[model samples]
Target chain A: MEFNDWAILEKRVIGWIRKAADHLRASLSNPLEISEKSAHNDLVTNMDRSIEQFLVGKIRDTYPEHKIISEEGYGDGSSDTNGILWLLDPIDGTLNFVMQKRFFAISIGVYENGRGRAAFIYDVMGDEFFHCLSGQGAYQNDIKLSPLTEIKIEDALIDMSTTWLKPNRRIDQDIMTEIVRKSSGTRAYGAASLELAYVAAGLLDAYFTMRLSPWDYGAGLILLNEVGGLYSRADGEQINILSRTSILAARPGLHEYMIQHIKEQVAEGKFLTEPQ
Target chain B: MEFNDWAILEKRVIGWIRKAADHLRASLSNPLEISEKSAHNDLVTNMDRSIEQFLVGKIRDTYPEHKIISEEGYGDGSSDTNGILWLLDPIDGTLNFVMQKRFFAISIGVYENGRGRAAFIYDVMGDEFFHCLSGQGAYQNDIKLSPLTEIKIEDALIDMSTTWLKPNRRIDQDIMTEIVRKSSGTRAYGAASLELAYVAAGLLDAYFTMRLSPWDYGAGLILLNEVGGLYSRADGEQINILSRTSILAARPGLHEYMIQHIKEQVAEGKFLTEPQ
Candidate 1:
């Protein structure tokens, strides 16, 4: 891909996302064939696969050289990560879509040589588009988002699933409870992509989750990067773009404090899914 | 008040709530003078006072014989729970208002001889108005809400602040943790009124909070009552409409199961605030 060619590619990506969102809105009223993937709560609907097909089809037709990674197995099983890669999650919060019918998003990120070039997270119900380029500023519905500044841990509002604070194999419940008790408040919106978008927009101060796939945080990481937000795995290692891992994303100062506390309290060699 | 007077009173109360919502929306753009009350997380703003004054003045002018109770000191300090009582919370989820500038609401409930006559919870920013008259059914922006049916605890989506699941004086941490583990999911939106409105709308299955003032849960209980939802304290006692108490509200069968489990696990006479 040429340097100047990136401009035309972004427009094409955003156009595809908008088209995919239309299909999602149309599926709201009609009956959906729902099934559990691995766990009972891990739901997947037909719309998830349909939207992925629509976007993946458009991408393959336009850029045949690009490789794809998606939630619904739209790509070949391979370990190579040396080309232009597209990470996509057609419906990030599938449970929310299945039960509440809202708070879900379509997330996609374009990477070159494992480096993000463009990202978009479309909130289908709210119709808010949060997107960003590699080094350029992030935007929500064409309005530029301000760069994040330092925030104190005492005043921070952490967004996390309560399951982590409950007894879990990944980490001790007491350790996570201390982190929540020290924060000003907590919210669990049940979507990683939208939760990360909230951190980029400064609506939420931090987000922590036990495990997420590459597609869950791919677009969010790009958006957070442009806004000066920070992210890393539980063990204080850089996140792998091709594997599942625990996540802790926040603004500059608070991330350091939270990650240090997590590292200090995480059990020795007992994390349910360690960062690889 | 006469039987037909209830009909005219409902119109006036709803009208006043809409006007109050407009003032709240306007305050969103203006600078708010904030101060902490009791605790750092317990935030109150200048808009709270101004809105309370506006609504209280209207109630006095229209119904001089009615008694009032409110968050701010707009009502006379008294233990009287008789006559046509009006309970008002000028702004519930004050922290959400001061920080996110959304999710807070103006909550009010009207009662005659300790029985609710009408209730309203208005989400100002989202422009959603949830209201109901006694035995007339609930409505969200003029759309009638359906009556709630039985649901199992395993499929329940419980809404509660994470603080309760942490080490607390009211109940043992393990007890609350069990409830969360059995439930499908949990959310903390930081607004009691909106959480209850979600219950009335069937978006959430149950709501559990340790302590809430009458003003916070007044309108919500009425809205839930019309939809055939159930409520009580953690100790299986009726809620006193004049005092602060622990709240556990859910659909019929789920509430019975949860309250029994809670009563069995809570330490003997250790609940921080018991229902009087």
Candidate 2:
């Protein structure tokens, strides 16, 4: 896509995200009608679906040719990212939105011909908008964010979910435990996009989680790419945006160190997947 | 202390905490002069001590007879809580303050005759002030907070540090891991006072951490007390306000459930302290 096209799309998308945020704020006054997704802990609410549909409608109206991959079934389900692809997570942290009525976000990533072109994550309650254009620097609410410098493991504060520390099917608990022990601190905000935004803003050094979908970290990945951050599968492989996989994202050296640590555990036959 | 006295003191202390918050906001504009305390991860900063001294000075100038037990050296170091006592943590999440420039808090707990009388925890950047008196309910920025209802373990969202989930010297990591797997979700805000306030506000069902000082949780305890929250050492014993100890604070039923779970681990010999 041309730079002019990217700028126009970015401006329109920001307006759409702000409008969706207003809808979210209005919906919070009423009691949420929540339902379960894959598991009881995995939740979806009326607002999640409504917001996703709202974004999908806006996207379809604005760019009729663009395909969308989104949560809540408001997507084209295109197998290949051949053209303009929009990945949308209308309510990234639905649990927080339903429970605390805050800490959720609207995340959107735009890709042209399978290449990231622009991305945006709007923290609805905090009123902070993080955005980036491919090859351009990321910004937090108009201020350009600086690239994260390399941090020592002992000085790093990691962002991870508690589920990864238990006997889960994805990775070994012992390996995850070592990372927790080695890092200076760990935080779990229950919002992948916000956590990724924090990584881009240098608020957190890294964030890793097992079993996240494309919409969960789609915009985050684009934002991180602009800020000199790295992301990969838990076993040090490239992440497939269409598949559910474990993720480890961090600044340059820390990402390499974590990947090395996890690889060593796998080599020692300690990192296990669930038995078939 | 009399209700009249409590009201007057609460007004005075709120002013002091707000003033300290303003000072914290101003200090963030300058580079932090950070130093280590006990270990590399254990941090202290110039603002921590300066904020403590400022609060101490205010307390001394207003009520010279009150004794203080604080993180920095400005405390009276009184062992006995016989008279009026002030427990202060100028910056509860110093790491967050120094790193994220947000999420930290100014915590102050006022006790009279060994009982919590009034408390305050101010989120400096968020501009949220949580305060409470013994009999009255808690207030977050002048809005009175409601009491928390009973929550089931399966539906609980816990606030805990990742350090406690590993093989630490305090409690068994296996037991903590089970709690994590069972809870609905887990969050680590990296600030004890803010986490405690979150529990009181019903944003999180519980918060637990090992080796917290009196200054770290004193204000939070008071706020939780007003909202019918229960707190104790992880081993189900009363927390000593003068020493470092593990804390498990939650709504009524969930607190009991967690305590019972921990005790069961102890009975099974799975809970272990480091070999002395």
Candidate 3:
């Protein structure tokens, strides 16, 4: 696409994100109809579906040629990341949305042939928007975000979920516990998009999760790339944006350190995921 | 003291908190001079001491009879919680204050004859002020916060630090892991005062910390009490308010459930803290 076309698409995406955010803010006063997804703890609310449907309708109305990959069932059934693709997670932290009524977000990313072009992650309640255009730069609201600097693991503050530290089916629990002990501090926000935005904004030094769908960290990946951060599979492999996988995002050198540490655990047969 | 006197003191305390908040907001733009505390991960900044001195001076000028128990050195040397006491934590989440530039608070609680009379926990950066008076009610900024209703453990979201879940000298790691698995989800903001305030506001169902100073959760305790919540030592004992101890804050019957579970662990020698 031409530069002018990219700019136009970016502006339209921002508009849609802002519109969805406005709807989210207005809907907070209404009662939420929540239902369980995979388990009782995994929740989905009425607003999550409605917001995804709204985004899908808007996208289809304007750019009918673009394919969508979304959390809710509003996306086209495309298996490959060919041509223009839009990844959307209407409510990134639905549990937080239903329980705390804050800390959730609307995350959207646009890619051309699997290369991220533009991304936006809006904290609906906090009113903070993190966006990036490929090669241009990343911005938090009006201020341009600076590239992330290197930090040591002993000084880094990591954001990770607690479930990963237990005996889960994916990653080794002992290795996850060792990571917690080695890091200076650990925080869990219960929101992947916001946590990724925080990492891009340099509020957190690193973030890792055992499993996340493409839509969950799609926009975050673009933002982190703009800020010179790294994101990959937990075992230091390139991520395929079309599938579910473990993720480890961090600053420049810290990513290698984390990968090396986890690789040692993998060598010991501590990791459950089969080597790709 | 008369009701009018209490009202006057509360207003004055609120004014001081707002003033301190203004100072904090202004100081965020400047570079922080940080220092190590007991451990390398344990940190204290210049602003922490300055804020404590400022609060102490205000209390001394306004009510010289009141004694203070504070994290910093500005507090009076009172070993007992006997008179009109003010518990102050200059900056509850100093690590976050120095790093994230958010999620920290200035916490204060007033006690008369060992009974909490009033409390204030101000999220300095977020512009949220949680305050309450005994027998009156709690308020979040301008809105009067409703009391927290009962919630079961399976349906609850807990706030706890990852450090406590590791094999620490205080508690058993396996017990902590079980607690994480049982909850709907878990979050760690790295700030006790704000976490406790979240509990009072019904944003979080429960919060537990293996170790905390008196000033860390002082105001939070009073706010929880007003909202019909309960707080006790991790071993299910009354917290002495003048010393360091573990804390478990939750709504009504859930506190007892947590106590029973933790006591069972204690009986099995999983809890290292001496039983009172």
Candidate 4:
């Protein structure tokens, strides 16, 4: 990688994100064309499609050699994460887009040779732009983010969807129930990238969720990496990035503590990720 | 009540709340002297005490005959809400102030003869002010909030702390778990008043919490009432201003559905509020 490659790529990615965000912010006044993907709760909107298309178009035109993986069906869907790769979630919280009108985000991560090169998470309504380049500092808008300091689970503020705390197919509900009861507090923003950005920016101590697609998971990993944060599959394994898995991202000590505790729970025989 | 009572009181309350909000925002740059309240998870800050003192001073100086109820020990300790009553949660989400540095709010509600006359919930860092004069529509910042339209539980975006979904002494965990699985999405902002404001602004379809004091409960009720929303105890009973009770606030149809569902669950005997 060239010295100026980071600067140029970061600028171009941010520019595309800002362009898409501007479109989204402006279109809030207009009616959205929405359709459910699988369930009524799982929503997809025209804004999601348009933003994905716009970003994919920009990437394909400028970096034609790049492979794209995205949520809204514009991706190349290459079998492996080789060469240059772009992972995008045009709207991280589609329900938020239609219902809340805020808290939704556009997430993009650029990877080269299966390593993160640059990542951006733009919160469209709030105008909070969280981004980072490999080995450089993470940023929420203009201010550079500080590396996260160690915190205990007792002192930490955790963010995760409440659905995970209920009886679910993903993981044992008791596992998260214990964490929520022990943590300083818990919040659920319903947007993966923004919640992860909050971890990087120190607004949240950690954010863990079950089974996020690559588009929802990739950019957040890069942001956390830039902030000296740690992440793994919730069952304490390495993230495959290509497969949907539980994500647990936190500061150094809390990450390890959570992973170890989760492992201990799994060892207890009833707290495994997959229930029979 | 005088003819000009609503107009005059609304202006004065907004003025005081904004003054308190400005103070909170300006002091955000300074370090807060924070201490745990009941436990490590429950926090209180010098900022909280100081804000309460400031608002209490203002109210007392303005209306000596009126009674004050507040968090952080600035209350009059009045047993009932008879004549002019002022409820204040000088800093809601005190942990957010110390840790996240955002999402905390200054909430104030004025009641005349046990009826809500005016209310305000201001987000200091985000600078969104949710206010209302009873019978005169709610407003989020300068924009007038629309009356909540009917929404189904399946389509509603709900907000509440995830802690309520766990096994607790409050409501049955399965009750909220069912609500979580049925709702389109759920969010927990960690501030009760701000979450209620989001509901009034139509950003969320509903917000429910296990228990809240009158200071945390009053301003939100006024905001919801102004926007034609509904609220009752999570057990489907009328709220008593003097007591800490579970609050189930929502738009018209969804609110009824939740209450009825919770009642049915309670009737099953596994879902009672207090176990024998």
Candidate 5:
């Protein structure tokens, strides 16, 4: 499809997705049906599955040739990103949504041949949506986001979980400590989609996570690109939209500085372990 | 005053406080008139003092005998909690209000003869008001909250910030590390009022901080007490509402277990200084 056609389709899809999510929120607000997934911290409720199913059905009926990769099992098990692929995280931050009843999001990204073309992140309770069409620009609701400009580390705030600083299976602690000490402030909002949205909104300067799936970050990638932000693996490698990747997305100047100094320091002697 | 009279007063005060907070939120959407306090983190805007002044003025006009203790310098500087004393934190998270425009609260507590009679925690953006009147049940909005009962440390979610976990002037990190490992999860929302409100609501099983002032936790203490939740110094000592104190508020079962093991450990020369 042409760029204009894709933009129109994306706007309509985002509207539908917003309506479906609002419906799900209303249905599950009073009496929620909850369940545990990988662990207690990883909570998935009925609304997650239902929302994913609704999105998948809508996409199937409207765009028959499109493929979907979703958090829930409703999507196809396709490994290729050659055609138009829709990535869906129906309920990002499920634990936050289930326990806190807030701070969760519905994130969707449309990509063509591994290049992100459109993105949408809807913070349900806040009724805020961050959207971007490739080369057009990023927006929150009706307001267009300004392109990220050069900001020093001391003037910038980084959004990252403290777990990254701990002795986890992801990254080195000493390097993470150096990064934290350099930034003005560090925050972890528990939802990757919202974190990405905040990065686009210029509320936060950067965000880095060790383990994240396509569903978690696909939408954010499109928004970041449009707002003059860059995303890469921990070793400064390009993110493969088809799989889980250690990701970092930041403004233009900060991204380069982070990769050369902190990223390299964190990945010292272990760069071979990163994807080729 | 009699219990029925106290109840009536609580209802009226809560309504007035809610109205006052809404007015502040609407009026102070931007920091066009902002200033610095003790430090950059300790932010104060015109609205902070204005809101406190309005509350104190209304309280004195409505009931001339009532005393007021507040963060802003608008209340009487009485040392004793004689008659009805109102504790006010006009904007509990001023840094958040000025910086993020969200994640802040208006905390108010009513005390009679040094005893808490009522508390209100208004999360302005979230539109959640957690409240309690002594002898009555705690509530999030209108729904009566369940009491703290039978929570395992392994299942408990604790509230804390990474800043505290680091070597700080106030707290010993050895015990904090153990607390981190033992709890199911840790969260830092940067707003003490809402954190305490969550503890009262049972969403967060526990919350603690190295230092907190009276205004930071007055309303939270009242709400937690109503739900049979415990709030004390980390060493299991009483917290003086007039002074800055170390805070440890948690569900009854987890509170005792944590204090006995964690707090006592820190006291018994098991301190681990944060990494250099």
Candidate 6:
């Protein structure tokens, strides 16, 4: 797609997302019909499915040719990211939504021929949106985000999940302790999409999660890409938008250093993956 | 002090906090005076100290008899929570303040005869305030915080530090993991005062931290008390606000259960005076 095409679509999709978010918010304000999916902690509210269906309908009506990868079961179940695709996570933080009624977001990303085109992440309760178009800079509301400044690892504040650091089949505990001790502080907001949005907004220098879905990361990846931030796997490889993989995204200067230092302590074991 | 006197004092203090927060928001908008504190990620900008000094000077001028305990070295050094003592945390989440510039709060609590009298937690950027006059109720931006609903462990979301689950000297990792697996989910917001405010607001079902000062919990304690929540040490004992202790605050039904379950897992020699 041409740049102008992407820009127009970006604007249109943002509007669609805002409207969908408003509808979803209203639905949540009313009593929610909640249920369990895989586990009790893993919830699937009726609103989740209905919102995804609404987003899919809008996308299909507007961009019929584009394939979709979304959280709920309404989108095309394509494996490869070859064509123009829209990635949607109708509710990025469902637990927060069901319990706290806050911290949840609507995330959407557009890719053309496997290259990220545009993205939007909206914190529904806060009414703040972080958005971006490739090569055009990232923005929170209308304020353009600044480029990542020169920052050392120790001086950086990170959003990290501690559940990933325990006696797990992944990274080493000793190294995780070192990172926590070395940094100014750490936070786990329980939402991968919002963490990435915070990174794009420069509220957090870095964010790492052991496992995340593409829908959780799709919109954030585009925003980070626009802000000159690096979002990749734990091994410093480019994130595969279709995989449930460990993610590490940070300001460019701190990403490599964090990965290098933390990688030395990772246990040598193949990560277990469930069938998608 | 009479109840009416406390009410008037709280109103004035709320106004002062609003004005002080306005000054802080303006100073932070420049983004030029940011500086590191203990680590790069651990920030202590000029704004923190200036704000603290400004608050201390005003309190001293207005209430000359009030004894103050604070993070910044402007308050009287006291070992006990004496008569009409004021606990002040100028910026509860300094890292958030210096980095995100949001999600941080200004916390203040007053105690008379060793009992919580009034409390205030101001979300500086969001313009939301969670305040309480003991025996009344908690308020978030003038809206009263409702009584907490009874949520079971399986259906509840709690807040905790990721470090607690790591190989820490303070608590047993296995027990912490058990709690995470049982709960609906876990989150770590990295600011104790605000996290406690979240507890009072029922945004979180429970919150626990390894070590925190009096200033961090005093205001939250008052608010939690007003909302019928429990705040105590990990061992299920009365919290000595002056000492660095394990804090666990939750709805009354869950407080003892959480403390009793986690207290058994305490490491024999893992106590730390300060949170890393």
Task: Tell me, by DockQ, which candidate is best.
Answer: 4
Please, what are the lDDT tens digits per residue for candidate 4 over residues A170-227?
8888887778888989988888989988998999998988878889978989989988
Residue A70 in model 6: lDDT: 91
* Best model per lDDT: 3
Candidate 3 local Cα displacement, residue A161, angstroms: 0.8
Candidates by DockQ, descending order? 4, 3, 2, 1, 6, 5
Compared with the true structure, what per-residue lDDT tens digits does model 1 show for residues A1-276?
Answer: 543577788898899999888889988999989988887778889999999888889988998888899999986534667888889999999988887788899999888888888989999988889998888889998999999999998889899888988787676666677788889999988889999999999989999987999989989999999889999987679988998888899999999999888767765443445634
Candidate 5: TM-score of chain A is 0.94
Cα displacement (angstroms), candidate 5, residue B195, comes to 1.0
Best first by TM-score, ranked? 3, 2, 4, 1, 6, 5
DockQ values, each candidate: 0.76, 0.82, 0.84, 0.88, 0.33, 0.61
lDDT score at residue A203, model 2, on the 0-100 scale: 96
Candidate 4 local lDDT, B1-276, one digit each (tens): 443467787788788888888888889888888888777878888889998999999889978888998988787867887888888999998888888888889999888878988899999889899998898888888899888899888888898887778888777778777888888888888889898888888988899887788899789999999989999988888988877778889999999999898888888885546212
- lDDT-wise, the better of 3 and 4 is 3
lDDT of 6 by residue, A1-276 (tens): 543587788788888888988898787659998888876777878888988998899999988888999998799967898888888999999988888888899999888778888888999888989888888888898899987765787778888876565655565445566777677678888778889999887888899876788889988988988878887787767777888888889988788888786656554443422223
Name the candidate, 4 or 5, with the larger DockQ value.
4
Candidate 5 off by > 4 Å: A1-4, A29-36, A149-157, A178-185, A251-261, A264-276, B1-4, B28-31, B272-276
TM-score, cand. 1 vs. native: 0.95
Q: Count the backbone clashes (under 3 Å) in each candidate.
A: 0, 0, 0, 0, 0, 6
- Once fitted onto the true fold, the runs of candidate 1 whose alpha carbons sit more than 4 angstroms away are A1-3, A267-276, B267-276
After superposition, candidate 2 runs with Cα above 4 Å error: A1-4, A272-276, B1-4, B272-276
Model 3 error, position B219 (Å): 0.5
TM-scores for all candidates: the values are: 0.95, 0.97, 0.97, 0.97, 0.89, 0.92
**Lowest summed lDDT over 10 consecutive residues: which window, candidate 6 chain A?**
A267-276
